[model samples]
Target chain A: MTEDKFKHEEDLFCSGHRACPGCGAALTSKLVTEATGPQTILSMPTGCMEVTTTPYPESAWGISWIHNIFENSAAVAGGIETAYRSFDKRNKEGYMNHEDVNFVVLAGDGATFDIGIRSLSGMMERGHDVLYICYDNEAYMNTGIQRSSSTPIGAATTTSPAGKESFGEDVHKKDMPSIAAAHGLEYVATASVAYPEDFKKKVEKALEIEGPKYIQIFAPCPRGWRHESKNSIEIARLVVETGLYPIFEMENGKITNVKKLKDRKPVEEYLKVQGRFKHLFEKEGGEEVLEELQKIADSNAEKIGIDKE
Target chain B: MTEDPYEDLKISKGAVVKPRTTLVNKTGSWRSEKPIIDHEKCIACGNCEKFCPDMAVKETEEGKFEIDLEYCKGCGICAEECPVKAIIMEEEEK
Candidate 1:
């Protein structure tokens, strides 16, 4: 067995918060907090994590945390970073060094891909030393699982339900990592909660850099995705193994590293496990939809040069 | 005593409250399934201790893994990751 790589000194994200059983977002938040450590201040937006973990008079956070509106976590984090920097300039001989502090914005897919994209883009453009992490659970799970732009094609969401005429969501998942890389950020990566070691390494690497960094972590939702709670990690791993989600890192708008799948599984293996895709199997003309999804995965594999012999 | 809810907001540093204050809320009742550790068959691999998202699994002084039921959400990641199959998830007794 591999050595325990994710061991940390503190449980920065403490238990007793009301995250659902087998919540990938909660787990990812914990892993991220552990990697960043106590010197960090987190700016969270309104979402499942924000609502669940932070009820009044009770908070799961062990570090300094601020909750912003749904669409302004990045902007708020930028403001906080500026405040710290301004204070540092005024107090040169002070006991604290502002450079030692880390500013982070943790938001969901709805905030990142849709509502808060403008502020996030602005933060990156202004070159704030903040790490913006989007825990992409696909749809808007907090707001009753509505279809967000990050929701993959053919997934049945509340807003885009499968009917006699429609076969679930029509649009594809947004290429958020590439979009972040396009902003010319110093660091951008995609990770999954299943791969804790890789996720931790990316978090640590993002903190070392001095500019804006974006990391979109694939956090599977058990309730939204309609999967057994125990199968969250299995589904997370399957998405990567089947080439549906490419785990890679970018530096200065260039792909610096890619985790290539040695033996790729068919996309069916992943789609078959989720309840959102159960309709795709039970309905007529569902195989065609599955083929189209496979094409998307295959194209991704080709684009990342993972399909090369 | 009905204290002002926004009293902390008046502070200079934007309300730096005490950390880990959530410890007051015991979430043990939230569990529908509970993880039972088989001590005799345990190898103390620490896989269960490491993968627990809640940090409810602890290593005792004797190096055996034990789950603190007060906080364990019973996600079963430990049972799934246990290399020795020493941990089992059973339905919580009502």
Candidate 2:
């Protein structure tokens, strides 16, 4: 994927409101809009990206956008696509038929995984021509860094605080790609802000597919995860290498391709860097948790078909 | 479905919440009903309780869970993550 293909003259997620410095969600939105172009209509849900970009009256989004409650973004996007198509079908001269106009839904992990899964599943099952992009910063950063269904096990969130007898967010993140693919949707993929070119390519691929498309983006939340803003890309890269978040895609219900990986690191490398996981190492029995995390990573590498080097 | 070998699988304190279908929770008056659950099945899994953006689900006694209908936006995580499928969401016309 070339950089030019993902570059745009107009910024969809502008440089104003309040996203933490070097916010990965911000970067993902920018790249998505650039790839999808300005004519896109964004169906946003309540989350960090939504809160940060649209602070009441002011908004950083440059495209036609609508902020719906957290769970119904997919439903709203589906309806918008239906409306757009119906309008275009009635009028021959209507500008709505332009290929640049993408009916896209931008949602967070909480919205996508736990809350919106039903509608999201419904949208895919219905085979609507919409793109659902989940910018996963792990925890629900908008609501004070609480745990979300997407919060990986052993990671600390407000709701899943590290305590003597507790393991943080015990369940694994719902595998969105697999779930969406199971619906026999045209496309489902994973991307990260660290790889803008790859991320843009995945968006483009989703557009080419006739039915619904889902892209779960691994966005870094520094404040919530207690990391420096500058290390967003670095940490994102580590996430992939560690197998915590593998970059891959599924077409229909079959695995088509997996991204290249060379230097595989222990999950502890990724965990040790974040303060959220600090307790897992600093606490008396934290090392055991780190070992458990390693097992999780190794298993994901195997399941996703990421060849060990 | 096969178990996700990656999960830590910590069972929270209390009776395991039984998973229910959408049909079970249907109340005629519900504009939307958020499932308040039994924490025993919860394992403090943080599945349903975690993603609730409205802060609806609260851990009461050691292993108990309750849903605050007042703040709930009607996003159904409690129903979705009930490992036992204990909770179900019902939307009734208001």
Candidate 3:
């Protein structure tokens, strides 16, 4: 590996915010802000990222940011992007050059998949020049690990704890990328903090495109996921390698690229490492539970074509 | 930031905080273990700076890496992801 690959830009998501020790979402925001640069304006909703970074008089962001409500960050961003486009139009009419500005929405799964999907859909359908990034930790991490629509099956969250009658989350994760692609967005991708280079590249690519773009990052939370702090990045990688999370892109409603798994690991390998899924290993009918999860990974691998030959 | 936060201001429509003022907070106190990089074995790949959730690891002008104790949360991610295993997390002393 060359040293050039490791070199990065200034931290737009500055330090001194109060994120938990090994927060994958924090790094996800940091890498995203770095890629977007200082010219960008951010609209963040109520989530772990908002709560951790902005506390009263201090904010970790170096760029201009706005915190609206839990369900309207995308709408706010769309409004701001629309305002910037108006400026572009008037400036062109007057033969003036105005500095380019990008409007981005940094939201979490609860806001994106459940509460704010309507607003997000409106933003995308309106074709606003906004890059909406959803940091999916698979649950409502900010509000004591509640379950959201994006929560994967067989994973225990506070609201979806594994028990005799329940097998953690009963429903499968929402296919958010496909939903975004259905809006005919120019770019839609699913990335992970485990692959930093790809994440940054996708952010840059999404910004370069003029229309609306959606990129959901698989951010792991050590606090909510019940994993070792140091294993945050490791578990993020396992999600991609296990085929539980497929990293792919859709351009103009066509699948452009998929990060094919070299040798896809079993769901057991990923589930065994986290405390949330520990019940799957020790509970009654555990093997059946695992089989259900394995089917999810298999179907994902087939649908996304991660096993390309 | 105003040392007397409430003393200086009129009630305005917006809240004003200077950029990067969070640097004033010495977050290093949050660390139970500190990272000490073995410069002799360091390859300067910059992974520590890149992967640090807190952005505490920085490259000095001398082309050397330094972890800003003021902001390093002692997460030990740098040590964990170090390609060359140059960084070791050492227990902090009272």
- Candidate 3 clashing pairs, residues 3+ apart or interchain: none
Predicted candidate 3 versus true structure: per-residue lDDT over A126-200, tens digit per residue: 988899999999999888999999988888998999888887988888899999999999899999998899999
lDDT of 1 by residue, A13-130 (tens): 8877787778889888888887999899999999999987788777888888998899999999999898888888888575357689989999999999999999999999999999
Q: What tens digits encode model 3's per-residue C-alpha lDDT throughout B1-94?
A: 6498778778856765665656556688999999999999999999888788988888887898988887888988899899999999999999
Error of 3 at B5 (Å): 34
Clashes of each: 0, 15, 0
Worst 10 residues of 1 chain A by lDDT: A1-10
Candidate 3 wrongly placed segments (more than 4 Å): A1-10, A91-99, B1-12
List, residue by residue over A1-309, the lDDT tens digit for candidate 2.
123221211335444435664467866877787788778888988988887666655566667778888889999999988887777878756566835478899999999998899899998889788999999998788889988888888888889988888767777776777888888877789987767788999998888767799999999887899986546677887898888888988877777888867767888888888888889877887777788888888888788878646
Instruction: Give the lowest summed-lDDT range of ten residues in model 3 chain A.
Output: A1-10
How large a fraction of the reference contact set does each model reproduce?
A: 0.46, 0.00, 0.56
| C-alpha TM-score for every candidate | 0.92, 0.73, 0.91
Off by over 4 Å in 2: A1-9, A92-95, A98-100, B1-94
